[model samples]
Target chain A: MEIASFLIVFFMVRYIRTSLQTAVRFPEWERILVIVQYAASGLLAADVFLDSSITKWLWHLLLLGMVGAAYLLKDFRPVRNVWLAVGPYILVSLFKDIAKLIDSDFYESISTVVEIAEIFTLVWLIATWVSTQRQQKALEKERLKRLQEEEQSRIIAGQNVMLEQLVAERTAELTRQKEELEQTLTELKATQDQLIQREKMASLGELTAGIAHEIQNPLNFVNNFSEVSVELIEELKEERRREDRDIELEEELLTDLTQNLQKITHHGKRADSIVKGMLQHSRTSTPQREPTDLNNLADEYLRLAYHGLRASDKSFNATLIMDFDEHLGKVSVVPQDMGRVLLNLFTNAFYATEQKRKTGLAGYQPTVQVSTKRLSDEQIEIRVRDNGCGIPKTVLTKIYQPFFTTKPTGQGTGLGLSLSYDIVTKGHGGELTVETEEGEFTEFIIQLPT
Target chain B: MKVLVVDDETDVQILFEQRFRREIRAGELIFAFAHSGEKALAYLNEHPSEYVLILSDINMPGMSGLELLRLIKTTYPAPPPVVMMITAYGDSESHDQAMQLGADAFLTKPLDFNNLKEKLKSAL
Candidate 1:
């Protein structure tokens, strides 16, 4: 019986130690249960060797305590296996011990039944533990799969946001570029307009220059012949006085010839002035500035331009109004160039009023007003205004552009205002601007630096 | 004194002759006419040292008055005839160029005969 108890104690210790290490169940309780089992086995061995009922009772109590502890803490999943395996063994042993204590006759049969039940309980506990381990491994694999899927979705979301931002940026850049292109197009159009105007003016200038050159030679001959005739008349008069052969009729005839010669000289000078005006208009010579009386210059051109138009159209007439600033003295300017500018403005003003008169509007009086005033110590202003068929608003801005004209095809070259603009602004460092309203009035303002 | 007038215009000869008719009648002055610079040069070659004054126009079809003036000033014999240049253009550039080419006087066209007569009287 001593050897048997030692063998049972040795096997129990080895089984509890192995289960505590290898099984995925009952870690804390298994440690406590191992202590209790060793105590019980020691007590049982001591009882069998010394024939002590106290030691036997102690062993049974320890086994009962272990079973009760396992039952009480059975909700702990790892401890559940310990409770399931040990609870049946403890109950069966208690029953067999109690049966032996109460009635010795049925103890052997009861021991046999308890042993079979304990074996069956141990097998069921092991199978339950194996299935629980397999289920836990599957749960761990499912959690890992879910984590990987979450990471993939997060990366995709980030990429989607980045792509959206890139698209938005590209759209903004395209819009900015479109605005820049529109601005450049507007600037190019303005430049092209300017270039076309310059080209037209250049060609017109060339044509007029050729015409002026051809007219000069014949005009010079007219002036020279008239002058020489006047001189010859004087010589003939001197001869008559020296010879004392002045018969009253011959003297009268000679006097009449002199008057006729004077008349010729006068008309010849008039034609010469017209030819010179044309030449000055056509020539692109460098400006020669000199101190000139602005009042005299303006008044002279006003009359010249008026008579010139009258010569062309005898029916056309307009009242000329002059308000010259007597206080404004000589201003340094290229007289020929400034004269051209004034002549052009005066002609346009007369033409406008004449056209208004030709409309035969009753109670309508055509008037052209030329006024000059000293604006400051360093500047002068000249304004030419006409109460006539004024400039239309549609063509106001384009008036200074060469080849822009309101007159019929052959009547106007369209370069008068453009040339005047160049003369005032470019040649003299002055400003030329126009103010006009349709069918009412037009005014050209010239501001020249002294 | 003999005066040579060189010009391309034929009418210039008639005008000069009419203006100086009294002087020509009195035998105080004589006139010679050449239609071009080349003709004037040929005349001078034949009648060397005969002309007291030579009046030439600056602009001509061939051998401009300035070129003729240059040749006359440099190649003529000592006591050369006084050469005067005239032009329709009165610009300072032409005046300066003619003066620099050794022209005795520069005059502009629609000539003042009184001034020319005075200059000629003083020169003689």
Candidate 2:
């Protein structure tokens, strides 16, 4: 009976030790279960080779260790799972107690029941072991799946870092290109300014011939008046030299001489002014601001440009039509630059009219008109119009481009309008625009901000 | 002799009066002045045969001396007046054109009054 009980106790201890080992997280409890199994094996050896008293002591020690193992296992997992081992342990104890209580006749029947209970305990151990094995296999597969997911995440993180580096490199390259383009734009602006200065100087050269002719008109008056003054002085001297001078004749001669001297002085000053005007036109100094009357400026340029044309082609002439704004106030402008722009516009207007006159169309009196207006408190407008060969549609857009000319090769430098446009718009923050018809007229409008 | 001088310069009136002062005062030559070609033509139309000689500046605005000469020679109702074309331009082209237009003489500006007097004497 003791051997049978020992066998059941030993298997129970072995089964729990094996099951607890699979719960490796609780290694201390598995260690306790191993000690319990060792105690049961020692008790089995005592039951087989030692005296009954020593065997009984070993049996009690084994039971004490089993109790401690059961308590430790219960603390690790579900208390209900503990009952699988505890219930069999209690049944084995009951079978040991009943085996002692049963008589010879009753023992035969009870022993069969005890054998069946032992077989049931063995089957329970086998079933629990199989389920533990399956649980361990599932846990192993989950661990492998987690490792693969972690590796995939690491690869994705590395790709993200590479993409960030690529974006940084492209941004640096774009920044370099942007700086280069800005430098190019600055260089273009400087070259444009140089070209504008050259064009202004070229126009001054073209005006030199016209300026010479204009000076001739005033010089003619000066020379004639001075020569007449010399004759008047001689006539007075002759009157004075007479033995008895006629008072009335002497007074009259003296009066004529005085008048002649005054005329000479006046015409000399006029010649001086014309020279001064020419000097102003040809000046290459930087622009200086002054208050200027547009009406007076326009009127003066109109004649200057006309004389310029007439001097070149003696027969060329036009009817000058001008209407100026009486209420237009003096505008602040760079006088020399503004004067050049006005001269260019007036020259163009007269040229157009002269060309129209050459066509010899009957009743065609060539007319060039200029008008000035105070368009608003912030703006002043000057319009120069000519009834002449109008600008063609195709070349209208290109008119403001540098070196674009419609005139015969030697006649036009082609920088007049382009330079004028820059002076008005960039220099003064103004706008230059044109309106034209194919055969009727061309009007250039300059809008200046006050 | 009645002389009509046409020029845009107002100073010409005084200059002519002073230059021909003796002839004017003695009444050997009577002087009248017009500032433009149109005025000169109007003066002629108003007093027919009053002016025997016309001295005109060729470059006057509105109507040039050449145009005035052509009009006086071909269009005037009375016997054609003797016309002289005067200009600042002393080019041969202008002198020839003025001569072809029936001008009695062509004169350049800063006019040589002595030469003018000689030409005037011969033409008269």
Candidate 3:
């Protein structure tokens, strides 16, 4: 029974040594525990195999050495961890040996229970350490993921801020550019107006030459007529002198000659008046800018303009309406310039009516209404409204542009309205604007300072 | 030939008379006068083709010289008497139109009688 008990203890130590060796090499203490456990198992197994008294005693010494090693290693040293792995095997071996020395079955059972309890404790410690390592690795992975997410969010926010700033900066730049573009457009318009004025002056020079020739043609008539009168006077004087004896006959002849001379003078003076009106129409450059009643100016030009239209197209008859504001005070403007403006307006009105008549517009009774009003303390407004064929909406924008005209090539110079616009806006420091619809009516508004 | 002289200014008549005194004595021309466009047209209508040439102003109150020229060119196409367009400002637009409308010659004033004579000789 003693030998059997020794063999069982030897086999248990051998199995514990194998279990320790199979455990992964972890902490340095655990490696040392595994090595000591291996040596202890070998010594116990040899004692059981030899079955000699000296071997038994040596096993007893070996067990004593193991217990001493356990106490020395137990002071929290690396060997203490090593012993913990081999501790169960060494204890089992010592308990069996002591049980053999005592030769008692009851003590052997208690030693066996203590050895099993120690082995179970070693396995529980190893499992606790492995699970702790796995949990630490998992925690590190979670921290890394959280840090990456924070960094990604920061990067996205930074990009959005930069984009917002970029858009704001671009909008500011665009606003400045738009303002500059508008300024440039206004400057271009002013320059264009000056150019038109220069061109109109050049055309006026041309008209001056035309008027000079026109003046000379009538002058030629006056010369020829007076010369004929002189010849007739000489002939009458000679007849009176040659037939001095026939007094009654000479007197009758003299009376007839005097009557013919008076007739000639009458027709000559009538011709002269017509030429003078033409001269006045053409020579209008020397403007007299003064505080003049625009209403009176409109009325005067309206008559001349209507006469001109009647002369040009004898068949056309259009009504001229004057709605001059009597209460409106005088405006500081060139009266002659304003007169020309009115003339141009009336002429355009008459021409439109003529066109409408030719086109067979039903009941197209042309009406031109000249109206005025005081808009404010500093400004007065004059409106020239025409019920003749209205300006087409598409062409309204180009009406004030120089050299833009609706009339045929020979009929109109296309500078009339452009000149009027310049005179009103630049010369008088006023405003000229128009309102019109395609088949309705056209109205030109001129505003000048009071 | 009985020629009509139409003019508004008395000074222009005096100058013309002083210039053409020698011609009158030689019976080279006869003259009657009307200054305005209406008078000139009336005279021309009364004595159509009687005058050798019509010296017409472009701008006149009763009727423009252009209107008179158009009337003359259209009414009397075959035996149309010569017309010499004269202006101080000889604009290309007016000059070209006048020539196209069968004006014999275009003359710009102050009147050069020497050029006038040459143009008249050519037309006659």
- Give the chain A TM-score for each candidate: 0.43, 0.60, 0.42
Error of 1 at A406 (Å): 5.5
Tens digits of per-residue lDDT, candidate 2, A29-124, equal: 666666766767777777778667556545644654554456564553532254464456456645545564566567666777776776677577
Off by over 4 Å in 3: A1-127, A146-330, A333-379, A384-390, A395-431, A437-442, B1-58, B61-124
Candidate 3 lDDT tens digits, B11-47: 4454444345446556776655667666887888787
Give the number of the best model, judged by lDDT.
2
Inter-residue clash pairs, candidate 2: none
- Candidate RMSDs in order: 20.1, 8.5, 13.2
Q: How well docked is model 1, in DockQ terms?
A: 0.04
Give per-residue lDDT, candidate 3, residue B47: 78
Query: Which tens-of-lDDT digit does each residue in B1-120 have in candidate 1?
Result: 999999876657756765676788688789999988889999998999999799998765446688789889998887889999987656677789899988999998768888999999
Model 2 has fnat of: 0.12
DockQ of each: 0.04, 0.26, 0.07
What is candidate 2's lDDT per residue for B1-124, written digit by digit as tens?
8889999789888888877887788888888889888899899999898898999998765677788888899888777778888887787878888899899888887788889887777767
Q: What TM-score would every model get versus the actual structure?
A: 0.37, 0.65, 0.40
Q: Is candidate 1 or candidate 2 better by DockQ?
A: 2
Name the lDDT of candidate 3: 0.63
* Top TM-score hit: 2
Q: Decide which is better by TM-score, 1 or 2.
A: 2
**Which portions of model 2 show Cα errors greater than 4 Å?**
A1-187, A322-331, A371-383, A390-438, A442-450, B26-32, B37-44, B47-54, B69-83, B89-107
lDDT of 1 by residue, A210-307 (tens): 33333344455555556666666776667678767657735654664565465556546655664564555445556478898888778757766664
Candidate order (lDDT): 2, 1, 3
